[model samples]
Target: MNQDIIKSQWKQLKGEVKQKWARLTDDDLTLIEGKRDVLEGKIQERYGLARDKAEAEVRDFEQRLRKH
Candidate 1:
């Protein structure tokens, strides 16, 4: 997803982000905030996903959040 869309609806996405990344601590979410790159990196590191797949998952989640 594009950064514009993510920026527009990040507040709503945050909850979904937390749910999907349940292993991430509150501090992790706090640190991620609106930075998709950071979020992608953390998800890759914590979940052992390849970089491209992790990014796509984050993009998918962000897009799903925007649809609501």
Candidate 2:
């Protein structure tokens, strides 16, 4: 999914995101606020993933969303 699309659909997507990355806190979600970069950074911080891995995971997530 495009970044703009993600941002626009963020409210609807937040539940799915929480399901996918349960480690993330409510505060994290609020901080992310539809920014892909912030989402990636939070995922990396919470999961101890490298930047590339985080980016890949988010990309895969967006692809899956597209399929649905």
Candidate 3:
């Protein structure tokens, strides 16, 4: 999803994000606040994924959300 759409829908998606990345803390979600870059950073930090992999994961997650 686009940043604007992501931000607007964040509250709804937050729980699903947590479920998918259980290692992420609530504070991390707050910091992410629907910014794709921030989400990628957090995923990298928590999951130890490389930058490209983190971006791919976030992109995949966004695609899944769209499908649903």
TM-score of each: 0.79, 0.97, 0.97
Provide the global lDDT of candidate 1 against the true structure: 0.82
Q: Which of the two candidates, 1 or 3, achieves a greater lDDT against the reference?
A: 3
lDDT by residue (tens digit), candidate 3, 1-68: 88999999999999999999999999999999999899999999999999999999999999999899
Clashes of 2: 0
- Model 3 lowest lDDT segment of ten: 31-40
Predictions: Cα RMSD each: 1.9, 0.5, 0.5
- CA displacement after TM-score superposition, residue 8 of candidate 2 (Å): 0.7
Q: How well is each residue in 29-53 modelled by candidate 2, as lDDT tens digits?
A: 9899899999999999999999999
Alpha-carbon shift of residue 68 in model 1 (angstroms): 1.0
lDDT of 1 by residue, 1-68 (tens): 67776667677777878899887777877788778899999899889999999989987886776577
Clash totals, every prediction: 0, 0, 0
lDDT of 2 at 55: 97
All models: lDDT? 0.82, 0.95, 0.94
- Candidate 1, 6: how far from true, in Å? 3.8
By lDDT rank, best first, the candidates go 2, 3, 1
| lDDT assessment of candidate 2 | 0.95
